[model samples]
Target: MSQRNYRAAIVGTGAIAHAHAQALLGSGRAELVAVADVDARRAAEFAGKYGGPSTHAGLDDLLREEQVDVVHLCTPPQLHAPLAIACLEAGVTALVEKPPTLSLAEFDAVIEAERRSTAHVATVLQHRFGAGALRLRRLQEAGELGRPLLATCNTQWYRDEAYYAVPWRGTWESEGGGPTMGHGIHQFDLLFSVLGPWREVTAVAARQARPVDTEDVSLALVTFENGAVATIVNSVVSPRQTSQLRFDYERATVEVEHLYGYTDDDWTVTPAPGQEGVSELWAEGRTTTSSGHDGWLAAVFDALDRGEAPPVTAEDTRRTMEFIAALYASAFTGERVQAGQIAADSPFARRMDGTGAPWEKVRNP
Candidate 1:
């Protein structure tokens, strides 16, 4: 594919939208032709800050006015599915942020929309694009890391009441399932990329610290199809915060420790006895900075240029979302949930909280 510039637009002007705008501007792969938000002023401000692209009060107006080849859905979780569907239907590819939708059913709807249109939709699982992560995946696939036996993923960060003051921060009906669905999902997505499909999960969740309808902290034990086991933790109450993932393979233990994003320096490889050369092999790869929206945008633009579906495809994103659904189902019903257990008709398929809002009872008391 020849190197050609594609016109792009951002659909929401929130805090994360700036990251999207800067990434698009920095990549030189796409031109930020426009921005849209419910607030016309916010859209204008975003345009002014990021090269003065056209601005509109809503996405529909932007879509109608601009010749956008790609649309970034930076809106809240609830709006992700519908807006993405709209973009794909109009023959424009969509790149959505994490917690792509409110439920598994909604994600399926986005997939259906993609199938009906020529354009494709991709979710933002940026951690999978980092050079360290890419190299680790390559090593594992080549059997250089041996077999992945056990792993731990933790997204333990701090979020106070003031952060939840946003209307959609804590509700199951809007923001999905708190940190498990929102914050830690980035780390878990990276874990899934390395470990592959999960088989079953058992979990427990609670609204221990924050006054919200979703769990502020949750823990789950997951069994993978490859016979590997993992313990996953998502929390927003920790005073000492970190986003960490540790994988214990037969020959070496690979770990990445960083708060938001990670570079090569943040990764550590400790080989077992007689495997001293593993560290040198781990460092044998192209070096790039920590993965973020910029890396993801580069991939998305390349895929578009090649006329192929981008990275973090709907099928891949569904596995992560299904794992999330299984976690919520297991946490709420006190049962082991399988990967395919949550179907379109299942209670958890409709909402992350499942059939009841257990947190509601505690909040009322």
Candidate 2:
């Protein structure tokens, strides 16, 4: 494998960009050499904090000037695809933030661009990189944990009015859907990583509180291809915040609870009668690395060095993104959406609320 160091750049120096910048620096194989944001002053500030790499007004200018190996897209949901496509065109890997695109249509466009480019696009669903998550996948595949029977993925956090006061926080055109797209997507992505593929989803979405254009809360019942069922809840109104996922296997029950990110310490396994052997499997190959941008970046760099596609590849990201679209489609249409049911022309594909969010109709009426 190659041992060459990589040049890295970051676009959109928002709050999430800080994590990307730090992760790039921590990777040891990559350097933060450039950054771009529409706000020149903010870009400059971000540059100053992170070894003062060059700052540009936008990705186009940054691309023209810097020859980077990877560009981290820390911009909002809408900008993720365009910025990533630009990176792909430049033959630079794009590490995009969650809700990789505003809609399935946009994500497909990015995927098409990727097919035509030499570089790749990776979504930053960092929770899947934790040591515990890795161990879980390994054990499950090795048949130590038995078949998955049921699961629950809940991302319940509090976001007040002030949080949505930001111009783009809660809008469909800007931030996409509410908690389901933004807050809980990490949990959703991590769940998909464990559960394999989903068959169908029945969901309901609502704007229970917080004045926003999108639903602040959503609940879904999903059936997986493996014959397992799961419940998912995404909300931003709960005062006591937590991100939790529980998987019930035939042999043992595994769970992880935390907010934002998690490590091995956050995971616990409860074995079924005579299934205590699974604990040993879970304990093997444990690492101190917590689930976060840093670990994900490390994996990306490793894949790049090995001349292989990185984790959270287009197929992986598309499945999770499709599930998000399916959740919204099911909620908006009051129908159970099957996998591969959403076509390019589907309203949900054109936009998250292609059929229009129910609450938006009531508000306008």
Candidate 3:
């Protein structure tokens, strides 16, 4: 039912890179063909740890050296665009990490590149395909959940001074933005996936937490194109580890919580008045998903096998980026940034340069 396995080449051997490589190895779906990084030593180190993936110092060399069918981009947000475009130019499909672009313009650039290149491209917004979300989709489609209404995304994650110690971790130039674009964005992706394309937004983002260059806290009021309004709160400064989406629909309410573990069973769907039997219908449509990152990689491979594109495309991610860019602009500029009103020329297009925001210093006692 499938063609031969597609070979794999990974870029950016960061912490998460190893996880992806390991998943690929474990899946038996693709071969570890090559790896590239700015630091040759790091590249070699990763290649060594894995199965001798060819190591390269940069993209130009890697693209020329490796016969990789797919490129897994594991770099920081700011680097995503150029590297992905280069991969496209080399006629390679790219599975990029979250926060697909630094700005809406860069997003358009990637989409344009994909349009022009021989390569079909996709991004990693992996949460939706999770077993929990998958079941939710089925339940909704089956009309067990009826018409969905309100949605809420809450992620209470914490990052301290140490987390930002890495040179690129907290910088606007390298990381794109703050937590709204980084730590909390995956959760945002999950929210958007379930809630659908959003309409107008009013948000406030702030960099009040650590020595970061972007906001650690953001609250947004967003309306969906379907006229459903949702409230979102994202932060890296909050204590307690939890993630949740509460979907209130016409027939029932469905919930998913706990980011790292569990599945559709985690959802407790409550049907509308006198519709108690809907719970059984929701439960009957159970599913299981590979770990979030693993599921995405597997899904990509599956799509490739099926001659279809990965579920999350550059255009899909661009919508998310557009909202995020608007969120940052709205919060940073103290204005209610308008969606669709934001163009490639909008201030959010480029990295936040020379904001003169102090690199918060912690007095070493």
Candidate 3 contains a number of clashing pairs equal to 0
**lDDT top scorer:** 1
Candidate 1 TM-score over all chains jointly: 0.98
TM-score, model 2 to reference: 0.98
Candidate 2's residue-wise lDDT over 1-365, tens digit each?
Answer: 76779999999999999999888887788788999999999999999999989999999999999889998898878888889998999898998988899988899999999999999999989999888888899888989888999999999999999999888889999987899999999998899999999999999999898999999999999999999999999999999999999999999999999998898889999999998888887887777778988878888888998887787899999998899899999999999999999998798988998789987788787
Which has the better lDDT: candidate 1, or candidate 2? 1
Worst lDDT window (10 residues) for model 3?
353-362
TM-score for predicted model 3 compared with the true structure: 0.91
For model 3, the superposed segments whose C-alpha errors exceed 4 Å read: 285-291, 333-335, 351-365
Best first by lDDT, ranked: 1, 2, 3
lDDT of 2 at 88: 94
RMSD, every candidate, angstroms: 1.2, 1.1, 3.5
Error of 1 at 153 (Å): 0.2
| Pairs of residues clashing in candidate 2 | none
Global lDDT scores for all candidate models? 0.92, 0.91, 0.77
CA deviation > 4 Å runs, candidate 2: none
1 versus 3: better TM-score goes to: 1
Better of 2 and 3 by TM-score: 2
